[model samples]
Target: MNTAQLKQEIIEYSKKIGIDKIGFTTADPFIEMKNRLIRQQELQYQSGFEEKDIEKRVNPALLLDEPRSIIAIALAYPSKMTNRTISKKGERRGIFCRASWGIDYHHILRDRLHLLEEFIKEKVPHAKCKSMVDTGELVDRAVAERAGIGWSGKNCSIITPEFGSYVYLGEMITTIPFEPDTPMEDRCGTCNKCVDACPTGALVQGGQLDSNRCIAFLTQTKGFLPDEFREKLGNRIYGCDSCQTACPVNKGMDFHFHEEMEPDPEIVKPLLRSLLQISNREFKEKFGPLSGSWRGKKPIQRNAIIALTHFKDETAVDELIQVMNSDSRPVIRGTAAWALGKIGGEAANLALEKAQQVEKDEEVLNEIDKGLSFFCKDEVGQ
Candidate 1:
């Protein structure tokens, strides 16, 4: 079986199966990535969600036996959501990043990888292939970059010239010795727009992201947002797109190729107040399909409360008071207290003062004090 001919056939099949871009690379250990990841670890820059075993992350041969080549695939998602919910004076909304706009890309990309695997097996009866999406041991972006699917963008995203960092990446390690594609040259040149535009300066130095400061990573933490970023949280309920939106290559780069990738305006940019009281079952049913919901509802709810404060949504003050009084999680309750303080009405201040008397958690107590301080700061100005 000629791998050159087989590679061409696989490329054809990929397009038919809705894969936007595909690339191939040798299954060598990612030495540069190892060094970079080690530096990130040393600096405590990792998001803590990554595989702790760095060896497993960098070596393809360890993950898959006799891995001759890696196949990287990218599917472009819509950058702009159509039928967006217009937030009025009283009805404000929080947004999920574009990556979580539709059904989880993991499911979508895995399905594509599965089909590709089946095709390769049919052609090479004894071919061994292992497929993986984001959760796998492999770093999907590194594989994609090496496979020529895209260059690693300044924002730490795999940025394809065709897809403009708006692509979901997946990869498969196969025993077939397919010829590798050349890596794309760094086209970003001197453009520091993405780094300059980061809200928390998460993109600390161009491509290097201090994940601790990344609003995207911060949005997914199931705890109180740091005092400094609480004001920077804005209306993002899940993930941050500040760097992506600021990219000059991503300018006017919205694509609605797949139906599953389309955003339901009501879901992605949902009403900030409505999220405050979402039940466990309701949260699952509504947002379960999106990739961003993997952290469950606590983080989203926590961010929603902060978002209310970002908008100073007086309408959410009553709900914030209720959460401060009754939410089961201390994080939610504490975040609600902080939101109330930022919203600062007589009712909000009174609710915080009342909750401080009964709240027991030390962290929650501190947040309650912070809420009361916001009121104190406001009075000083008045």
Candidate 2:
């Protein structure tokens, strides 16, 4: 078959496999993206990259490891799934971003790509193919845009007219050359709601994302969170969608009905009280199949405590005290102390004294004292 016919067939088969959009490109623009990465590294924005690897990202030959056409695919995720309201009560809710709410997209898309690869190999016996779904060094977004899938929005997400920014991207790199699609026009004009709505100002100018202040990265990081960013984290225990939520293009899209992507019932709008009680075994069981489980439960449980502190729900004092006194995780204990201080009252003060008496971690002890001061009266009663 001719390149045009092959491209058309691939697009048709991709749609049949449940992908929403498909397009093709030469994979040459990856060089420019590599240059951009080099600049980012030079500017000290990225760490642990040798200059050679950065150059490789821009070379199409290096991306595919062979000269071939590229196929870019996009899958629409339900927008309604992202709007679930989590409760501050002790019940605890799991908050999975709509993109990651259901089964892992990597497996789904890779399976389809394998089918396509088999089809191509049958047609051209000597053809070679490789596929990736956000797991490679190549810039998928740049290739997707070049292939006419959609334009990059101001929030650094691809925006398709039919699905807005609620789409997941994947690609197949093949030795068989195919006709490429025409690039799409930019639809986001003069709208800065996404930038304005970012709680940590992660979206600097236009499409640039500062990973340092990104709540998504912060929540996913494995260690103790910096205090400054914790306060701004709000109630998010997983990924933060404030930028996507504020996009005008995504407005009015119902994401709640996508049952496949629903948050695990145990974690759906979980209460701070119950989140504090998650054992390591329970943490593995509850979040193991989900994306946020990569960092284990400590970071998420700690985030829950921060959110509870922000809520200032005095009713959570007992749970916070329990966490502060008995939780083995220092980050959780420290955050619990902070939350108790925020919810200061007679009960909280009493808990703080008890926590301080037995706390071995100096950091946690300091947090207990801080909580105590908020509730304890001065001798002068001023």
Candidate 3:
């Protein structure tokens, strides 16, 4: 059979295996993407999680030998939960963003790509294929955009006409010289909703992001979150969805095609207090499957403290006091101290005063001081 027949079979087989969308493109160097990446690095706009080598990221040949074509795939995730958990007066909850809703997309996309690799190998015994998901060197969005999967939206997410911006992208570089699909035209004309909606103004301009100020990036950090972004975090425990949620295109786009992509409401939106003292094993057992938990329980726990502060749930003060006084990690302890101050009460103030006497870490002491300052401000106002 010809390469065209093989390509057709791949497309048909992709549908059978739950690949929501597939497109093909030549394995040419992404010239425009390279320039943009260089600019992002120059401006310090890139998330440090990306591969450091710019050449390797934009060049398919660097990743695969004699690469002739690339296949891009997208799997749509649910924007709305079916059995959504709601937060109430005493029982406030923290949220993991929709991207982290279900089982980690990294695993799900890899399973699909592995199947595709096997199918291609059977057709052409000597065919070469290299696949990667979000963690890959080749930018998944760039490959997807080039393969006509979707147009890159202003929010820096691929926006498909059918699925909006709610899709997880993956790609495979293959030696087969299949015909490339025409890229979709940019449909985000005159829409700045995503940019305007960003809580920390991380979306500096259309298609450009300053990851340092991004809530999504901030939530994953394992430190005392900067004071500026802390309040902006609201109740987000892992990732922020302000920009995506504000996109007019993504409105009402909720697909539950893959069962693995379905979110467990309890895990994604757990009670804020419960996370404060969760054991390491308990956290892993509950959240390890979700991509957001990759940073371990520290960041999530820290964010949960901030979330408790966001709600000003006085009930959480006791737990926050425990975390502030006894947590092993200084970052978590310091953040809990800061949160305790934010949720000021007699108990929280007494805890902070006691912590100041014994806390050895200078950073934690500073946070304890900052927490006490809130009470000072409150007293002066009264």
Candidate 4:
């Protein structure tokens, strides 16, 4: 079969295997993306999670010798969780962004790509292919954009017309020179909703992001969250979808095509207090399967403390005090101390004062001092 016939066969096979969208692009170097990446590095806007080597990130040739084509695939995830848990006065819950709703997408996308790789080999026995999900040297979004899977929305997501921006992207580089699909036109014309709605102004402008200020990146961090973004975090425990949720294109876009992609409402929107004292083993058992748990439990626990404080749930004072006084990680202890102050009451104040006497970490002690300062302000105001 000619390249056209092979491409057609691949497309048909993709649909059969539940690949929601598939497109192809020549594996030439991504010059534009390389330049943008350099600018992002210079501005200190890139999230540290990205592959450090800029050349390997943008040049498909570096990843696979004599690479002639890239096949991009996207799997749409559910926007709204069915059987959603409603947080009551005493049982407030923190949310994992829609991206983290189901099983870790990396596994799902990797499975799909594995199947595609097998299919490609069957068609062209001599075809050499290298597949990667989010963690690959090549940027998934850039490959998707080149393959015309979607337009690079101003929100920095590849927004497909069918799935909006809630799609998981993966790509495969192949020696076969399949016909490249046309890149989509920029459809976010004059719509600044995503940029304007960013809580931390992480969306510096269209198609550019300051990941340091991004709530999504911040929520995944293991250390003490910067004080400036604590209030901005709202009840988000892992990832932030504010920009995507604000996009008019993604409005009312909810697809539950894959059962594996369906979210367990309870896990995705777990009770804030219940998460505070969970053992590491318990956390891993409950959340390990989900994409949101990649950073382990500390960040989620810290965010839960902030969420409780955000609601000023005085009932959580006891739990926060326990975490502040006894948690092994300084970040957890420090954030709990900070949250206790935010949820200020006589009990909260007393806990902060007690923690200050024994806290060994200088950072934790500083946080304890910051927590006590809240009570001082309350007294002066009165």
lDDT of each: 0.93, 0.73, 0.93, 0.93
User: RMSD for each model, in Å, please?
Assistant: 0.9, 3.2, 0.8, 0.9
Q: Number of clashing residue pairs in every model?
A: 0, 17, 0, 0
Query: Where does candidate 1 stray beyond 4 Å?
Result: none
> Model 3 — which ten-residue stretch has the worst lDDT?
318-327
lDDT of 3 at 360: 99
TM-score, every prediction: 0.99, 0.88, 0.99, 0.99
lDDT of 4 by residue, 1-382 (tens): 5999999999999999999999999999999999999999999999899999999999988989899999999999999978878998999999999999889999999999999999989988989999999989999999999999999999999999999999999999999999999999989999999999999999999999999999999999988899899999999999999999999999999999999989998899999999989988999999999988988888899899999988899999998898888888899999889888888999999989888998999999989998999999999999
Candidate 1 residue lDDT tens string, 56-116:
8989989888999999999999998778679876899999999999999999999999999
Give the deviation of candidate 3 from the true structure as CA RMSD.
Answer: 0.8
Better structure of 2 and 3 per lDDT? 3
Q: Candidate 3 on 185-209: residue-level lDDT in tens?
A: 9989999999999999999999999
Candidate 4: residue 81 lDDT (0-100): 77
